[model samples]
Target: MPLQRDASPRMASMLLTTYRALGAAANPLLRVFHRRRVKSGKEDVSRREERFGRASVARPQGRLAWIHAASVGEANAVLPLVRATIERGFKVVMTTGTLTSAQVVAQIELEGLIHQFVPYDTLPNINRFLDHWQPELAITVESEIWPVMITELERRKVPLIVINGRMSEGSFRNWQRVGGLARSVFGALKMVVAQSDADAERFKRLGVASAVNAGNIKFDGKAPSFDPEAVQELQQRIGQRPVWVAASTHPGEETQVLETHRLLTRAFPTLLTIIVPRHPKRGQLIAEEIAGFGLSVAQRSKGEEITPDTDVYLADTLGELGLFYKLASIVFVGGSLVPIGGHNLLEPAQLHCAIISGGNTTNFAAVYRQFNREGGALKASNPVELAAAVERLLNSPEETEQLAVKAAELVAAGAGALNQTLEALEPFLRQETSRQRTKGEV
Candidate 1:
């Protein structure tokens, strides 16, 4: 809701009150929506109550820090923070919105970390969640500016800080249009630790009292992990084949990738193109697309083994991008080709794959710019360009290795953000520790 003209405080309250009432009234409809998602494999049926703020496991005995990360990317960025918080004597409960994110978090089993599906933003859900956890303070990772949660946290006097905060241009413009409402929500934040100066400035303009640029925490993250034995098995299966990977591809980009694969095969006859979709559920459709191109394809999800005749290998499984990155020396990070910002490049960079990306990486403007400037990654504006980049890299293995080294070096140099974030979070964590000790929670 846009805050009405004249910026009356009463108007903002009325709008929020109306929002809460509407959410309360839609309880039944929301249940139906949740059921539909479960049937579609979007929600975990066993843990459906978690979506309504019902806790499946009992809250632990110590002072708890609640972290809400909207999806995998944000979750990955905050992992180091989660570990550091645990090391500093705090139990952490991390929430993520998607099923895939829950799966990813499950794979990375940390001792003091608890994973829960994020409660819906309705007042009832938020209140129940906060009541059950009784968290010392709440933290959000990157772009998770839920208005109701912020408002409720403010009412309860729980400090809510945003780590690795990011504000995209389009989002900033939308918030600017509803200036007063934006102010009401953002003003409740204790602090916003932004990824870039531009993002910090944008948060400040939106009425966050404190916004600091702490750099992107993803840079300090370890590369996606894989079973080395799985990598070795795949290497044996792919022996002597020229392999190139298209990782985390989106729908529109995959069509182009299939075409590029078709073209790449003409020059390098033994080419093995691997496509890992951003959503693994799209694997079946992508496998069909590969077949429509009149190429032999094997889908990893179906336990199909890669064969000499296979032109494309659809790596549709989750938490295995590291395996594919290890197999392919040349990699193209996806979601950039069709203006969907971009996926994480640090994964390939850390895994020592020569990285290539589409031109639309506004979501990671600073890092992508530095990558291009340092010859750490190549930019392909379209499918034709992507094909050429792959062809060129395939012909020059030494150049590909050099690019990989440059990217990995750039990443190593960018590794201190996690330390800086921990330092910034020290004040809040310490205060909570002291208070919890008084209450016998420490």
Candidate 2:
């Protein structure tokens, strides 16, 4: 698809202005404080730059298939694809936007994979990045469509594809308002592989002609391999207590979860609630909040042992979701309770934890919608409903087991998307190999 020549300049200007305004409005107070600290010499920019340079250069590259994921969620979604790409004998270059995601990727010990911060979306920076390690093909794990980067890639004639492509209803409406400008931007891509039919249709409306519904890549993610000895140790430590995990919970949602925990404790005396905040910084805050509930809480950070009387367990660490999911009976996928687009419910589903979510799951709407239809998940709209659902499941062993089985089955059925995605990429890979061969002869 070629860029739309008829895109209105006025509409483009309007769209840019709107984005700037939104950015200004949504800028975090923490970012402002961080900037002030850097300006005041409390933080060393030079050291930061040096560290980034070292990390970037450490990345090994050769006939690499590069994938860019904007954050931790998107980064995790690419794991299956990364493994498949590596198995097919292509070195994988995975780029992410956040330090946490980078750290997580670093810990993975992927033999043929490298992690790097994606260059800023400017032509010079992108070109510098491309020059360091030329990729055979570039795939972006969700909707990270930066015009300057895409245009540069197009100029270099690099093959680019958008995998697990999703446009939120809110994003779709905003793109509709910009008309052909959005269309032209999406048109630059070689293909758009959507997570759902709705996403495909939305891309079509935006003039993305080469779009296909390939399902979500997250659905193809395998449960993180757990050490049997470690699982047995944790299980023995956890005893016969009924444990519910609130995974990837956000700020306001944590308080709601704590309150729900208090309500449920009255019914099931041995019920243990595990709260894993989406941001680890909130661990201390969540601990304080749980204490304010007048309940004795155990902190994973403090290495405290959980007792029968312990009301809440605060998991304040990173990259131990495999352990948490293994211990949980019913897991509430957070970020859904509040409006912070839902976290990955598939993680818990793959681990065979009975899945529960709230209504505000716009980010993974298609995935959750399918899970709900498949009888693999339960939806709760409020704290009371969440508590009731938890209580019902905790009291009924048969129902809980049935839900977990169904959820795991749903995940198993969805695992072939990775193979499908790879099949779609074979042509581009062959084309790139042919180009390299011709260049070698010359």
Candidate 3:
């Protein structure tokens, strides 16, 4: 629902009330949508009741801090903060919207962390979630602004912090149209720790008074982990072939990657190209596209083995990007060829892989620019450039190694955001700890 005009103070208040009422009234419709998603394997079938604010696991004792990350990327980006919260001796309740993120969280061996599906933003649902958890503070990562939930949290006086907060140009423009509603949702935030100065300023203009510029928390996230045995086995199977990976690729960009692979194989005849799509569900479509290019495809999701004849290895499964990043010396981070902003660059860089990307990386623009200046990444604005760059890197092994070293150095230099963020959040954390001590709950 669109927010009405904020011409006057009373009108703004009325509009906020109306928006909440409409959201609560749409609960039945949301339920139907959830059912459809469950049928399509998007939502976890057995965990459907969690969407209605029902808890699958009992809440642990003591002060619980709730961290809500919308999806996989957000969930990954906020891991540093989650770890910090746990180390401070607070029980952590991590909530995310996508099943993929839930799976990712499940794989991570973090103690004192509980994963739950974030409930739909209706009044009753919000109340149920709040009552069950009774969390002392709530922190939201990125730009997931849920109105009814914010209102309920506000009413309950739970401290809200938005960390690693990002406000893209498109989102800022959309929120501008609903000035009052934007204020209503953001006003509840005690503080917004932004990824960039631009985002901090934007949040202030939109009604968040306390938007502080902290470096992107992804910089402080743990390096992608891999299984040693699996990596060794895959390395043996590939057998000294020239290997490269194009990771988190979007729809139209796969064609460019496939073409690039075809070109690279000319220089290094036994070259193997791995394409890890952004969405694993699109694996079959991507395999078909690779086949259309007359390339032999081996899909990881289908248990297809990567053989000598396999031109392309499709790492189209969830939670395995680390294995592929380790397998390849040169990595191309995708979502940049087309206008989908861009994906994270630190993962490959942290793994000491030389990085390449297309020019449309408005998201993570600062990180990409810094990496390029540091000789850690190469830019390819078009398909020809992409293919040429990959081929050049493959031929010059020493140069590739130098770039990988620089990339790792850059990643290391960008660390410490986690420490700064923890310092910034210390006040709230201390307050919650004191409250628990006073009540003898800690």
Best by lDDT: 1
Pick out the ten consecutive residues of candidate 3 with the lowest summed lDDT.
1-10
- Please give the CA lDDT of all the candidate structures: 0.88, 0.77, 0.86
lDDT of 2 by residue, 35-109 (tens): 675664333344243222223464464577778998887887788778877877788888887666877788897
lDDT tens digits, residue span 367-404, model 1? 89999999999999888899999999999989999999
> Model 3, 133-245: lDDT tens per residue?
98888999877788888877787788789988889877888887878777877888889998889889888887897988887888887778789898998899899888899
Best by TM-score: 1
* lDDT of residue 213 for candidate 1: 88
TM-score, predicted candidate 3 vs. hidden true structure: 0.89
Candidate 3, residue 100: Cα displacement in angstroms equals 1.3
Better by TM-score, candidate 3 or 2: 3
Q: What ranges in model 2 sit over 4 Å off?
A: 1-55, 58-62, 86-90, 433-442
Model 2 Cα displacement at 145 (Å)? 1.9
Regions of model 1 farther than 4 Å from truth: 1-6, 433-442
Q: What is the C-alpha RMSD of each candidate to the true structure, in Å?
A: 2.8, 4.5, 3.5
